[model samples]
Target: MMRNKIIEMRGIVKSYYLGTPNELEILHGIDLDVYEGEFLSIIGASGSGKSTLMNILGALDRPTKGHYYLDHLPMENVRDDGLSQIRNKKIGFVFQTFNLIPRSTALKNVALPMLYGGVPRSERSRRAAELLQLVEMSGRSHHRPNELSGGQKQRVAIARAMANNPAIILADEPTGALDTHTGRLVMDIFHRLHQEQGKTIILITHNAELAEETERTIRLRDGSIVDNRMNGHYQLEACNESV
Candidate 1:
């Protein structure tokens, strides 16, 4: 079956201190395509440009030289404000740190993106409640970040990421801070979302075992793709088990 392409990046080059002796290039040149409703993982060691690639993929940063089409929109043509709008509308980010507002309840945190997107007050609350329930966080909807366990906080963060019903769920080491068991629970949520909701997911992680759980894995080394492998029923018991 032919699938729609959700993300396409070509000749992506990221460099710092352009036109100077101190210039340093992170990503050499990357070409990537992510299909709609596909769960893909990018795995690499630290300093291997995983973070750099992710920033570009998430539309948080632009490549110095390259083209990126997100949902078929040419990203290089978007202005700063337009990029912000695109991020809010098309890209959902779930980070390792669970970047929640300490002062806000889980429901409020999940509703924040909607508030910024100009969703009506009543509508935002209704949707936020629904998202929390989706992530199994409805019971903790009234709790603050400090009051929730790490796993619960991460779940709430995941719920928040789904607030805008983005075209892509970009998860950056979503389970990095949790225990193996808790992380498994979080990973299960991602699998469920993919299988049930047909969500397009891109997971940036270093754990090869975790990457295997995805439909495909792309390995990066020294700022270049080293391997692109379709994972066929890899064992799940070893996924970050020793972390």
Candidate 2:
């Protein structure tokens, strides 16, 4: 039997400042599907719609046209509360900036999401500790954001993102702030999560090399998907021939 799709987007169109003369469409009729355990990367240059598409997929923004289904629930018809529930329960996000509270300890930062979900204090601490260990940050659990290195801070952010055991993890330029070796370490963690934990990961990056590490790569240009390939394989000859 085929694995169910975790995310489905059909003819997704998004525009900023709709109806005004300055209105500009960012995503144009995007059609994409992500399977339950797939690791996918979306790559594009600056001004491409990769970030816009990521925002829509993560439900941080809604499409002006088209449909989005997350775990079989239609998002277009949901109210704000329903959307928020889905976001909290089904999806997690990591950003390049790490986004951890400067004054909070790593454990506290990771525990905040569970607190929002109303988990008990003991259970929250247990889960947060487990996730921190998963990211190899158990020793630094008491460190504040400022006390950690850039890579360590991002690891803490990743641990926080996984605190709720979300089905999908959305990462935007997750390694942008790290040095080359540290960036590879972060990617190794992501790879292990997909391989061992069966998590669905969608990463957005401007680096072509990073995109090649995923199982699938979607290339966007000027707000459109110029190329999308599976198994992280694309032929220069084929692209040249198409052009």
Candidate 3:
């Protein structure tokens, strides 16, 4: 059986301040494919264009050249409104900073995306509560962002991101702000989402060790893929022996 390709990028070139004295091409003619229900980690050092690729994949930014097909829809020529709609419907982003509204309750924060999608107030609240419960933050639903710990805040953010049931979940340095213990918990949540919920997760991180946890790791260097390994089922002993 042939599985569906959830994301496809061909000859993607993204540049900042184009045609100016300070013009910088961050991504250079990159091509990649991400499939449904696959957990892929994009690993790279600082300033290696991994973030630029992520921004393009999430529809947060446009590529200066080439095409991006997300869930079979080409985003190369999409207007801002169309891009925004595609992002809201097909992609969910989890940022390192959590990006939650400080003044709003966790439930309200999670419900905000659905509200923007015009979901009714009553139904959105119901769905928000369910999502909060899934992230083990139901008890803190009424608490504001300032009242929660970093991990709790991230859990709320995860629930909020899932509110729209997006096809792809783009997590950019999701555990960057957490302690090791909290980071493990967050990764465990993501693991469950990938394994149990069967979500197509794209995790962008600078940490190589973190990439080991995903099903496949694509290492980027100087705006290109240095290595792509599908070592999803590698034994710990085998990895240690190879090391």
> Which rank order by TM-score, best down to worst?
1, 3, 2
Judged by lDDT relative to the true structure, which candidate is superior, 2 or 3?
3
Better of 1 and 2 by lDDT: 1
Q: Which residue pairs of candidate 3 clash?
A: none
How would you encode candidate 3's per-residue C-alpha lDDT over 19-59 as one tens digit per residue? Answer: 66988888888989898998999999999999889989999
RMSD in Å for model 3: 3.7
Model 1 residue 33 CA deviation (Å) reads 0.3
lDDT of 1 by residue, 68-155 (tens): 9999999997888988998898989999999999999999999999998999999999999999999998899999999999999999
Q: What's the true lDDT of residue 227 in model 1?
A: 90
| Candidate 1 global lDDT | 0.93
TM-score of 1: 0.94
> lDDT of all predictions, in order shown?
0.93, 0.90, 0.91
TM-score per model over all chains = 0.94, 0.93, 0.94
lDDT of 2 by residue, 204-223 (tens): 99998898889889999988
- What's model 3's overall lDDT? 0.91
Best by lDDT: 1
Which residue pairs does candidate 1 place in steric collision? none
